[model samples]
Target: MIRGVRGATTIEKDEPEIIFSEITKLVQEIVTANNIQPEDISSVVISTTTDIKSAFPAKAVRSLEGWQYVPTMCTHEIDVPGALPMCMRVLMHVNTEVHQKDIQHIYLNNAVSLRPDLVK
Candidate 1:
């Protein structure tokens, strides 16, 4: 079976390094907490707020982790009124034996408030 993990985070600014670090933290946290392996991750779908286009945040993963073989992509989040700005969200689909309810999700930074129940 395949399990999914979702995470959300906000960038302090549009700079590439900042976006890179923040996303790296977010992805690593979710992966580690769930005991997920790099090869087990089917793929990751990342979306950033309209305010962020400085760099491909997904590259953050490749540079910081041993997850180079895992497929990843980045896209723009749909612009909506009153939505969080300068934010990046990821939905990770993994090939795992874990059940959906057993998977862990992460929400950090200002995005933490988006799903208080999931923050650890």
Candidate 2:
């Protein structure tokens, strides 16, 4: 079976290091809470709203756990009028037997308001 976890977060500022750190922490939480394994991850996709061009969120975590070879892609989100600025989102396709409801998705910082349904 396969499952997917979705997460989003916002940078408190435009700082590159801060953006990278926030993404690293959030990705770690999402993976741990869902009991995900590096090998179990099929693919990961990330998107940032225009204001967040500092770093690709995917690179922050993938490098930490030697997941550097994972299939990762980053792009820009749809720039709707009045959308959240400096936001980064991730969709992880995982090869797991867990049910969709059992997978714990994450939304951190200002982005936590984006998906009120899932949070700590």
Candidate 3:
């Protein structure tokens, strides 16, 4: 069956280096948490708040070893007043045998507020 893994993180700034580093950390955490291999991922969809425009988070995911073949896309999150800033989110579709209820969703840094219920 196909399952979706969700993750979110915040960057200190919109600089390319920061965006790259934070996204890399977020994706790595998700992969590690889920015990997912690159080949298991079908696609990764990433989005960032309006304040983040220095780089696309998907670019950082693509930089991961063995992830070049995974389908990925990036987009802008809806601008909402009072929303968290510098937030990057990812939805990874994976072909796996894991049950939906057992899938782990990661929320890191300031983005943890976005899903307090899912925080471990």
Candidate 4:
């Protein structure tokens, strides 16, 4: 079955290195939490808040070994009033046998407030 693993993290600044590091950390945590291998990932869709324009989060994912073959896309999130800044989110589509309700969703840093119920 196809399962979706969601994750979000906030960067300290809009610089490329900060964005890359935060995104990579977020994706790494999601993969580790779900026990998912890169080969099992069908696709990854990443979005950054409007304030983040320094780099594409998908580029960070591509830096991972074996992840270059995984289909990935990056886009900008809609700017909303009072929305968190410097935020990057990802939806990873993976072929897994795990039950939907059991899937782990990660939210880190200030982004954790976006999904208080999912934080652990």
lDDT of model 4 at position 80: 93
Q: Residue by residue across 90-116, what tens digits does model 1's lDDT show?
A: 999988888787788998899998888
**lDDT of each candidate versus the true structure:** 0.89, 0.85, 0.93, 0.93
Whole-model alpha-carbon lDDT for candidate 4: 0.93
Candidate 1 residues lying further than 4 Å off, grouped into runs, are: none
TM-score comparison, 1 vs 4, better candidate = 4
> What stretches of model 3 exceed 4 Å from their correct place?
none
- Model 2: colliding residue pairs: none
- Alpha carbon RMSD to native, model 2: 1.2
At residue 120, candidate 1 shows an lDDT of 68
In the range 22-41, model 2's lDDT, one tens digit per residue, is 88877888898988878888
Off by over 4 Å in 2: none
Query: Candidates' TM-scores?
Result: 0.94, 0.93, 0.97, 0.97
Q: Any runs in candidate 4 off by more than 4 Å, and if so which?
A: none
Model 1 scores worst on lDDT over the 10 consecutive residues at 61-70
**Model 1: colliding residue pairs:** none
Q: How close is candidate 3 to the true structure, as a TM-score?
A: 0.97
Model 2: what TM-score? 0.93
lDDT of 4 by residue, 2-120 (tens): 99999999988899999888989999999999999999999999999999997888988997998989999999999999999889999999999999989999999999999998998
Tell me which of candidates 1 and 2 scores higher on TM-score.
Answer: 1
Structural RMSD, model 3: 0.7
